[model samples]
Target: MEQAELPSPPSPARLPWDFHPALTEERLRLCGRMLANARRDALAMARYEMGDDPWSVGCRAFAFGRNRLQRAASSGDYPWLEVLDDSAHFVFVIGGNGNGVPVRFYRGAADEPTERTLRRQEMEVQQLSLALGETEAEGLAFRLAVET
Candidate 1:
């Protein structure tokens, strides 16, 4: 008797959403919107800085957890969602000093975040806070021991 040949595994889908290119386009639009908003704020700040006017430099931070459910809809890296959901939380800490005191701000996600993702987000927050020169300390923080 001749041995039968087994079928090969199916190829992974290229798009994360059912809508194919539409999802990619949507995400790109979101990125563009964010950039445009940033640019507008930057221009306003530049105008304020030109006249030697005192500007409020403060950090605003926000963090949210992403679960497998959310990950299933994301078009980005799969490993990020997997690791973040499985084993590590992402914490963003932003520190800056303006008038005299050192200010610290923070944001955190309950779900696990990959080291690379966490680092990238952390750096972004840090740079933003530093640029502002004032930090608003708020949000989640990791505690080794809970004090009653």
Candidate 2:
């Protein structure tokens, strides 16, 4: 009789974003739409600062685990999405909303945002919260204990 080999375990990095329990398609779609709104709003802000159309300006948004330093297993199943401006001056986190329909927001990004940048990001978050039919405080907290 021939011996059979066991299948190797899945790579940590190969895991899909939807592997997170709360990362539903609906939520991801909502996040993307909200990020687009944020980007469009930022274009106006950028125009206000630079006095131009900012037609070429853009931003990037993506999903990531709660704790970037830790393995996915240790990071829990909640998903966090980030939207960062092209200038790298502004960024914000759309935290897990749990059973709620509104998305949450938090400070910080790949590049450290300055006080002025953070204040601008806060204004966007406040607007987003109101648009989502929830108060900023209601969607303010992170879902998992893991720090981002």
| TM-score of each model, paired residue for residue | 0.21, 0.27
The worst-scoring run of ten residues by lDDT in candidate 1 lies at 57-66
lDDT digits (tens) for residues 1-148 of candidate 1:
9989989999975432232222243543343343344334444554444453322211111111222223332544421211212223332111112111111212223244334333334433443344333343122122111011
**Candidate topping TM-score:** 2
List runs of model 1 lying over 4 Å from the truth. Answer: 1-23, 48-148
Backbone clashes, each candidate: 3, 0
Clashing pairs in 1: 84-112, 88-112, 88-113
Q: Candidate 2 has what TM-score? A: 0.27
